[model samples]
Target: MVKIGIADTTFARFDMGKAAIDELKRNCSAQIVRYTVPGIKDLPVACKKLFDEQHCDIVMALGMPGSKPVDKTCAHEASMGIIICQLMTGRHIIEVFVHEDEAPDARELAALMEKRAREHALNVVKLMFKPKILEKEAGTGQRQGYEDVGPARI
Candidate 1:
């Protein structure tokens, strides 16, 4: 049996962790270990605990960085921590982040977070158990609903 760990922050309006869990449950049976923290900065430790204590197979670390410049900096730092944790543990940690300032309005932000969470949940399932489901788009560079912002080669 696969154990999925979910680390979520309480700073967001939408319930991204729940959305991810719901999406995951639709595909197959698995035990979901959930840990909620106060903000993005707390995500790394929470995820570490979930892996070391709960024995999760894969982890989804979800956060919503605010609109301030300092918030982005915090997000970057938190991301680095997560990367370090993944390297140390030799496990996959899906970073599910939706910056609060990405959308212009509240409704759009909520919708995007929900959709993104669910999509990433499926990705978690694929990465852990069914790799074939994800292989169909191996090199398509298709990010679902997100617009492509490929690098420039000028």
Candidate 2:
């Protein structure tokens, strides 16, 4: 059976992870494996464990970077490690980050996180089983946290 690894951060809201898993369960048949860490910098190790130790087919690294340059730097480093892990394992690791500054308020941030995570869950399914869906979406620049700009509006 296919397994998906979810590597989330402890500092961020839990709703994002829950939303991703819920969407995955609603749309895919794969088993969901989750691992949470303290912060973005810690994601790499957790994601590594999921891929190497848990043998997941794909991994989703989810986190909410703080509204500070230092936090961005840490997220960047973690992203690099995730890339390295992907290269070593020969598997896909989807990086989903919702910076704390993305929204104006806590409620808005929560909504955006849910939307982004749910959208990414659909992407995971497409990457694993139905890539055509993503291809179709390309016509509109459809992606998580992105506003669709359909075909250049010609």
Candidate 3:
């Protein structure tokens, strides 16, 4: 079995991070691991473990992109571009949904991400889960979405 590891950081201001994991659990094939570290040293260990212990062929990471939101058109296009760039890595990198209210959940994201992954002949070693905008935060400036690593690594 191809092992995939998911790492996430708790977002104190919103629920999107947790929701992203829930969506990922519902959709993707990779094993999910939550990381609550305050520093980078504690976080990257999972990546090493995925690379060393489980030997996961890929490692996808999920986290909120803490920036003021842009308009819909730019946000959507930019998010898609990021997804495509990640796909070029030949690994899956389900990114946090920039437009949470409008974006699809993990299942849908995985399907889309996988299709893109295959286009570049990259085996999916990891799947990242990004949440749509939290229900309460709808219409706020926050954007949400998912992304995966891509074939550029291959």
Candidate 4:
């Protein structure tokens, strides 16, 4: 059976990991392992440990940065760390980050978190099982949370 790792942060007010796990369970028979940390900056190491210790095939790093400027900086740093981890592992680490400022209201923020997490979960399935599916959708402006922007006319 395939193994999937989920690395999430408690700093996020929403539970994006649950959404990803739910989506994964609904779609595939992969073994899912989750590691939770206290903040976004901790996600990279958590993911690396998941890959090294738990022997996950792929990982999803989920985080929600607050609306403050400092939070944006932290998010960017965390993103860079995740990228480095991916390169070091030579494996896919799907980064799902939802900034608190993306939505105007709490309800919308929560909704966006769930939508993005679930969509990325499906992407993981496609990547592992059906790469052709994603190849066909390339350049289609496939947004996860909000409506897809669609391909722009050249």
The 0-to-1 C-alpha lDDT of every candidate, in the order given, reads 0.89, 0.89, 0.41, 0.96
What is candidate 4's lDDT per residue for 1-154, written digit by digit as tens? 8999999999987999999999999999999999999999999999999999999999999999999999999999999999999999999999999999999999999999999999999999999988999999999999999899999996
User: Least accurate stretch of 10 residues (summed lDDT) in model 3?
Assistant: 119-128
Ranking by lDDT: 4, 1, 2, 3
In model 3, which regions exceed 4 Å deviation?
A: 15-17, 28-30, 39-45, 68-92, 95-154
Task: Tell me how far the alpha carbon of residue 57 in candidate 1 is from the true structure, in angstroms, after superposition.
Answer: 0.6
TM-score of each: 0.92, 0.93, 0.36, 0.98
lDDT for each residue of candidate 1 in 1-154, tens digit (9 for 90 to 100): 9999999989977899999999999976999999999998999898899999999989999989999999999999999999999998999999999999888999999998998898889888889888987787565554633764454555
lDDT of 2 at 20: 93
lDDT of 2 by residue, 1-154 (tens): 9999999988996467888999999998999999988888888889889988898999999999999999889879988998998898899999999999999999989988988999888899999999987787777767587676557665
Best by lDDT: 4
Candidate 2 local lDDT, residue 55: 89
> Measured by TM-score, how close is model 4 to the native structure?
0.98
Pairs in clash, predicted candidate 1: none
What is the alpha-carbon lDDT of model 4 when measured against the actual structure? 0.96
Model 3: per-residue Cα lDDT over 67-128, one tens digit each: 33643454455356545544554544443333233324655544433433232112122222
Off by over 4 Å in 1: 144-154
Superposition TM-score, candidate 1 onto the true structure? 0.92
